[model samples]
Target chain A: MDMRVRLTLAYDGTGYNGWQIQKDGLTIQGELEKALSRICSASIRVHGSGRTDAGVHALGQVAHFDPPPKFLNVPWNRALNAVLPPGIRVLDFARTDRKFHARFSARAKQYSYTLWTQGAFFYPQRRNFVWNTGPLDLEAMQEATTCLTGSHDFNCFMNKGTEITDTIRTVRNILLAPGFTPQETVVWIQADGFLKQMARNIVSALVQVGRKKLSQAELKSIIQGRDRALAPATAPARGLCLEHVTY
Target chain B: MDMRVRLTLAYDGTGYNGWQIQKDGLTIQGELEKALSRICSASIRVHGSGRTDAGVHALGQVAHFDPPPKFLNVPWNRALNAVLPPGIRVLDFARTDRKFHARFSARAKQYSYTLWTQGAFFYPQRRNFVWNTGPLDLEAMQEATTCLTGSHDFNCFMNKGTEITDTIRTVRNILLAPGFTPQETVVWIQADGFLKQMARNIVSALVQVGRKKLSQAELKSIIQGRDRALAPATAPARGLCLEHVTY
Candidate 1:
């Protein structure tokens, strides 16, 4: 009666060290494993779809784990949520076949970055959830995203020191939309895969273009050059969120 | 020359004691005074419309202070916001007549209390801003509000140990509406003035009616009884917010 369970998680990453298990800091993976182990009364391992940097939130981060038959009768989602801290929640859970894998079964992912354009004051409630950058040229940023669509070698947007040799990523779309507030904007990017710091770096480059510090043609050149140093510095991790994953 | 300035303030009260200045704990008033004093190079005292309880938020809390003429050249709102912590913000500021008083000139005030009915989990970002109660009978609550409207002595709903003797107050309206989330509900109450904890106690009584623990006629009797001991416990301060103050 052993079953593999797939769980969709949502978490506020303000206090987490990221999705991976680290020895010195708190992490999403560490908390999930501990909660699952406590609930099942046995050691449990969870495999996440991917690693998110420190301070990056997630609304639909998927994971998978195997549970013994005795625990299967319990309402797993509610049981897990009761033990988890308020910052992390299990949004959905279901039994899956043994062949299903959280990381390998995912086909695409989407990330959204929020920017507060108002300079007069910062919203206290959203202090840890958004990037407060005073005013940007919206038209310029929108035009810059046009060039970012489609498949490209995103090595320039990737963080240095990463071991992945394949720098290519297929960007399905790049969208800029109004956020919940009038002074906020959301940048949503969908891609087959992302390199380390790729989403944040891409946002930084778009911001530079909006600020008129880098021309559209220069952005194109930077991507073509495939040099990380040539692009603008990576945007802060707080503004980035893993919004969805398409399987 | 001294110029009286009116400031509309907003703050997330998660980290502070309350709006009043307290010796042993951090408070919104203390922080505002410190920021204003630093900006003006002198000790500045601010007069708030009223004091909000510990953990109560505000969207349009009004205050006033006199500033030296030299400081008028500075953008007061922007300057104060720069120095204030992220939890507090100055939403608006303007020079007012010497006769205008933040506390005395206010005609009425509006307060809103948010109740999160979703029992599945708590929202981390809103942990300090909402009351997490499971589902309630919205229609029953609405019916119960009918007994709470109009001018009356709200002694039964008032928190004990207050020095104010007169408890008669005019309630302009009591509104119950759906909150931003489908699982949440908002209670908006407007009045000439509210005694300490009156709004919260009222809501608590209404919730009792919603749960069928109390009847509408019994709620009317509680108001007529005018005895604080006869009423239900006051609702948590985290759910209450000073939404607006009318001049």
Candidate 2:
């Protein structure tokens, strides 16, 4: 009988090229594969809940793997964490029915893009994890996000080179939290799925709207237009995080 | 006429040893000295409000520099920030009275220590900044902070190697914020001054107190004892931040 394992992980994406396997450089998947390979005594390919862009971090990223026959008794959760690098950690692991897939069976995903409105040097500590955007109008950004709620064709917010067949998705929630000091503004979005540069693009547009360069109607029109050229540029990937994945 | 320049700086302590000018290795002061030497056309020394340990960071670190007559008209802030490396940035500059000293004139210093209690590998994104532990009880920790209040002999919390005649200091506040997701905790402390490793030592003691290993009376005894052997070990330096200094 085949065994499937579900593992929830958290990683700092600064050192890796995101969650997938890459031919040229380091990746979260590459590291996990190496660790799993050592534990299972054979090669293992792990499927992630989604593809996170380079520099995008994760707090609750889910992945699954089918253990080879020889590795039946390994206590995977503890074993993998022991050999993994200090930047990536496995939070939880459990043996699941063979049918469970980290990628295909996911129902909805949540992401958060963090921006700091004050402090010049981008926090010397948190520089890689948050986008530093001097000071922004939070009320304006909150009003602007209302336009992005519900299902819509988000082609305008997709990355230029994305190879996806569909850009339609439903956004379940859009939460805006503006900080009082250290000056921060956070946008949390939950959806069934996201397009290639969807979060970044949405952030870009929302940022412009926050700056009062674009109005809420302008955002609605950009999505209605379904043209990638109509949206603002993608926000930097460093500030975005894959918050959670539900399967 | 003597000129005292007030400077607000931000630095990544990972590469440099700390803020002070030391013979050991790269330091934030050494970097600023070199930058100022180039911009002012003469060598200068910068004095910081406090000395942060190696691998520590700062957001609102204040420093002062007194330059010779020749560079009086130079646009120091903008020119210096332009030449400084990516990791260090100068936020602003102002000319202070000749008697203003960065260290002696500081009225109070606030420090924030970030604790991630989720055993997850700190994301490379935040690796240099936060201290990761796993699942801590915040209310218990807060309840224990009461022991650290008022003026006490802090020799127990001071590092063993530091030689200081006076161990009495006043802790104005010890604020505990519960973790964001049951896996994070933040402790912010404000004091007139801190001895070497004082903040880390308090955290170490508090962690034990949080875990119910030590009673509040024991904590009081540790402070009242004035013996370094009575306190818990020092927490790691990475989790502590030199938040602000009141002049």
What does chain B score (TM) in every candidate?
0.97, 0.93
Top model by DockQ, which number? 1
What lDDT tens digits, residue by residue, belong to model 2 across residues A6-54? 9988888886888889887899999999998888678889999988988
Candidate 1, A1-247: lDDT as tens digits: 6589999888889889999999889999999999988888788899999999999999888999988777766777888888998888888888888888999999999999999988775667677778988899988999999879899999899887679999899999988998746778999999999999999999999999888999999999999999988999999999999988888
Please list the C-alpha lDDT of all candidates, in the order they appear.
0.88, 0.82
Error of 1 at A138 (Å): 4.2
Q: Report DockQ per prediction, comma-separated.
A: 0.44, 0.43
lDDT of 2 by residue, B166-198 (tens): 988999999987533344577999999898989
Q: Give the TM-score of candidate 1.
A: 0.88
- How many times do residue backbones clash in model 2? 6
Q: Model 1, range B1-247, lDDT digits (tens) per residue?
A: 5579899998988878999999889999999999988888899889999999999999889999988778876777889889999889998898877788989999999999999878665556566778887778879898888888899999998897689999999889998987745667899999999899888998899888877889999999999999989999899999999989998
Please tell me which predicted candidate would have the highest TM-score against the true structure: 2
Please give the RMSD to the true structure for each candidate, in Å.
3.0, 2.9
